[model samples]
Target chain A: MNTKELVEQIYKKKSFLCIGLDVDLNKVPKHLLKLDDPIFEFNKAIIDATQHLAVAYKPNIAFYEAYGIKGWKSLEKTITYLNTNYPEVFTIADAKRGDIGNTSTMYAKAFFEDLQFDSITVAPYMGKDSVEPFLSFEDKHTILLALTSNQGAFDFQTKKIEGKELYKNVIEISKSYHNAQNLMYVVGATKAEYLSEIRGIIPDSFLLVPGVGAQGGNLQEVCKYGINDQVGLLINSSRGIIYASDAEDYAQAAANKALELQKQMEEILLFKK
Target chain B: MNTKELVEQIYKKKSFLCIGLDVDLNKVPKHLLKLDDPIFEFNKAIIDATQHLAVAYKPNIAFYEAYGIKGWKSLEKTITYLNTNYPEVFTIADAKRGDIGNTSTMYAKAFFEDLQFDSITVAPYMGKDSVEPFLSFEDKHTILLALTSNQGAFDFQTKKIEGKELYKNVIEISKSYHNAQNLMYVVGATKAEYLSEIRGIIPDSFLLVPGVGAQGGNLQEVCKYGINDQVGLLINSSRGIIYASDAEDYAQAAANKALELQKQMEEILLFKK
Candidate 1:
């Protein structure tokens, strides 16, 4: 899906919430464990329950990869299901993959062509050549890691390079990449104070913010500085929503949690209007 | 495998030559393409032919991940083959993966536990929390990307951070991680001039050096500054070794190419002695 369509969906659903499918079997409901593919089942249930309250589903690739071939199978099934059942809801691979030029091309093919994710998160440490391969793909988005939500983001990202923060350098440099219009960015909601400055660098680009609720990032603070005229912010909630309740009503419980966030997003959008 | 064991294997084999199994179907021999699992078959042939010459095998994960499920299956079979048959040889999953603390644990599990690689390459952009989890794994090495072989390395890696290069800061900061002993680093052969300074920082840590032949890195030049008492370098040549020929003699051709590098490595070890 294109940026225009994503914005359309956000307005249509009255939400810019992106549910994170970082499914770990240990955390899922005990009853779902008996199923043939528990991971896919859990994701299916969550998507069904909260698809309306969200415009995107971001799957943390590490969770699926930890399970090996079985995990890859589940991932394939999940992507296929999302594309077939609800194509309108954007899909983010959240793979955080980047490599040398040729190798990065292989990764782009894996996530964008084969798995068919609308976008995949990429690390910017390898610099231009490592990231540009993903940008070359028409219509497919590449969410570059500008300033992550994690504590580690301070390690190298916030450090000064040429008298400017590395994250800002990344945002500034990436704008010049080939077909850079397809570029989006991963900015942590935990660092909401940094958003206005980040917005100053790339005011129009979408930022997939992943830190709220469980990570102690306030939604109001994030929206206060994050949202643009097109509402270019995807506030992701994983553990706070998915693992809400492990009982049979786990899906409903997840929906309730999502409803709370969606209602707040709705109010924010209305107030902005 | 531990550092001691890896060093022992390097000395015993008289070659720290790391064969990169970056098997792209388009580049492989036509005959192998007829096989059910061409990727695995190609890898097995190459491993069988060069097992005695090379001390380690580094399969670039992006190559496998490109093929999706079947590719993962091929990777599984190839690794299983390497472990079972050539148990003495060290394995490196050139995945170049890193994430937040919890997610890093999942990636460490995927490569170290699930994939059972002796070492896995990780990107250091996220800093301490993103990398320490990989270090926590006993006997499993975390090869951090310090200076990559690609041109993009010059983009941010060489940039001064607080009057010191970011790559140097990465090496310095990573040393203070949880289990610093388990940390190796990826210092590309293309950047041989940076080796002495890198060696000054982490003399004992193993450096997986790619860009030997295909990317125009000199093994002799690399050995002059990069080698330690244990000959702390795994010189990787992917296309120059693996894709030596696309005819029926592909395996033999690959072995011949690996032997040339192995011979060069042997000379380096002998000269060092």
Candidate 2:
């Protein structure tokens, strides 16, 4: 799906929201454990509760892969559930997978073909061959990790390459690659201050942002700098939303948290309009 | 096992051979496809055939993961076969997973604890917090992707961060994180020319060299520049070995390929001493 179409839907719905399904087994509602598949149970409730308010749902694959086969099945169930019930919601496999050319092609098939995720997160360390294969999918999107919110982000991301932050250079040079429009980036909300600068470099591209809620990133600041003419942001809150409470009513609590973010996002979109 | 002890074993065996099990479903033998679990059958035969000739057996997760639940089960069976039958043979998940702090911890658990891989490949783009989680596991190794052999590897890797190549800086800085001693790097053999430069930064650490066979990496060039005093190289060949022949003789062809690499590696190890 073209990002402009997503933005158009966002404006029509008056919400610029994305709910992150980073379901952790230990942290999920204890009552849900009684179900045969706790991960799918937890995700279904959250998706049912918040689907109307969100434009997308980002599922971090590590959470599912942790439980091994059972976890992956739960992931498949969750995606199938979404497709069957909430097909309008965009799906992102937050799997930071990158490798040699042939290997990367298999990964593209894993997410895009086997799992049917709308987008997949990729690391740009291996350069064009590793990432271009992912971007080649005419209908799919590749979310490259540019500047993250982690402490080690400063380790090499900000390193100056020819008088520019390595990340800045990455965005500039990555633009030159063929089929660049399919490439978005991950700019963490905790590092929202860099959004103004990031937007200045690549103004039109969408950003799949994490670190908004439990990480204590102020949503307003991220919207202020990260939003574009099309309202280009998918703010993800994992712990803050999905783990809102461990009580039996955790789903509703998650819905409440999602509603809070959705309301704020609506206001931002209104302001932009 | 300590890195030095592992190196000693490789030296005594006169081989730094790591047979790569990047199994392609289509390349699997037709006879095995009749088995209840074809991929597992294929992997078991290959592992059994070449376990002695190789010091390590790296099963790239993508090939198996592309098959969905069956693929994951195949991966589990592959690792289980490796651990149960040949425990001394080091196992690598070849899953380049890295994310934020808590997420990274879960990924570390997925591969290292849950699956019990001796090592897991990690992408270093998210910085130290993402990578440190993987390194924190006791005795388990985390092989970070360094200079890869693909065209895109030049995209962000060779970009000078503060006037030094990003790959070099990643090695230099990652060397200082907690439990960094358990760290290794994935330096593709196709990029063998830069191996000496990589070794200069982290001379004593192990390098998991891929891209040798089907990817056109020269083994001689890799050994000449990449090998250190410790004989610390785990050169991997996937398609060249595992998929050498797609017929019933596939595993036998795999054994021959592994033997060829081992023979060459033995000569290199002797020449170095």
Candidate 3:
């Protein structure tokens, strides 16, 4: 989906929430094991439960890839399910993938063409050519990692580069690339305070914020600095919602958790008005 | 394979060449398309013909992943073929992957456990936690990108941070990780001059040097600054070797190309002797 459509979905749903589909086999309910593809079955239930409450659904590709061929098939099934059932909802392959120009084109084709995700998260370490291939796809978003929520973010991302933070430099420099308008940034919600400075760098660009629910990021604080006029934020919650309950009522429990977030988002939007 | 075993293989073959199996369907011989799995068939031919000339096989994962499910199946077949028929060869999955701690563990499982590759290339942007998980796997190698061969490497990699180049800092900091012994660095052959300084940081660690022929890197220069006591370098040549011809004699041509590199490397090792 394009930025305009993404923003439209947020306003229409009264939430900029993006549910993360990071399924782990050990954590899943025992009954799911009976199915031929438990991962897809689990994802289908969660997506169905939370579709109305979320504007986006991001399946972390690493989770599916761990299972090998079966895992890849599960991923295909999940993406197919999302596109077929909820055409209006945005999809992001939370696959932090990047390589050289030609190789990256192949990756762009894999995620954007074959698997058919509206967007995929990319690492900025490989620079412009690695990322530009994904951005070149018209209307498709290439979410670049900027100030991630992990402790490792401090290892190099937040370090000083000519007096400015490395991530700040990344955000500033990336804006000059060709088709820069199609670019979005992944700023972890755990560093909500950094969002204000990040906003100063790219005020108009959408940010896919992941760390709110399970990672101890406060929603109010993230919204305080992250939300733009277009509600330019996709707050993602994975384990907190999907694994809320592993019982038979797991889907209902997930819906309840999503509904709670949606209600808070509605209040946040109303307050902005 | 362990460092000892890898060194043994290099000496046993009198070559440390790692042939990259970056198969492109359009570039392959037309006759191969008539096969059931053209990509795998092409790779099998390349491996069978060139296995005696090279000590390692590095399949650039993006090439296969680009083809989606069928592509992944081809990857599985190629790896299985290599492991079954040529057990002595070291396999490197040139998939530059990295994510959060938990996510990276899944990737480690994917490449090391499921795919059973001896090594997999990982991008260092995410820092300690993202990489440590990969390093945690016993007897498996995590080849971290220190300085890439691409033009985009200058964008951020060569930039200074606190008076030290970012790539240099990456090499320095990563050495302090939990299982740093299992770590090897990827130093592009184009930057052969940097190898002396890189070698200074991790004297014993093996470096996977790409960009030899197709990218205009001088093999002699790379060997001059890169070779350690164990002859610590796995020089990769992809297009120059694999795409040597488009005729039915493509496999034989590929073997000839690999033989050329192997002879050059043999000369380099003989000089060391």
Give the DockQ (2 decimals) of all models: 0.84, 0.84, 0.87
Q: Each candidate's TM vs. the true structure?
A: 0.99, 0.97, 0.99
Candidate 3 positional error at A140, Å: 0.6
User: Across residues B141-234, which tens digit of lDDT does each residue of candidate 1 receive?
Assistant: 9999999999988888999989999999999998888889898889888889999999999988889999999898999989999999988888
Top-down lDDT ranking = 3, 1, 2
lDDT of each: 0.92, 0.86, 0.93
**Per-residue lDDT of B142 in model 3:** 95
The TM-scores of chain A alone, one per candidate, are: 0.99, 0.97, 0.99
**Local accuracy of candidate 3 as per-residue lDDT tens digits, A134-210:** 98998889999988889999999999889988898889999999999989999999999999998888989999999
Could you give the CAPRI-style class of model 1? high
> Between which residue pairs do clashes occur in model 3?
none
Fraction of native contacts (fnat) of each candidate: 0.74, 0.93, 0.79
Ranking by DockQ: 3, 1, 2
lDDT for model 3 comes to: 0.93
Residue B105, candidate 3: alpha-carbon lDDT:
97
State which docking tier applies to candidate 3. Answer: high
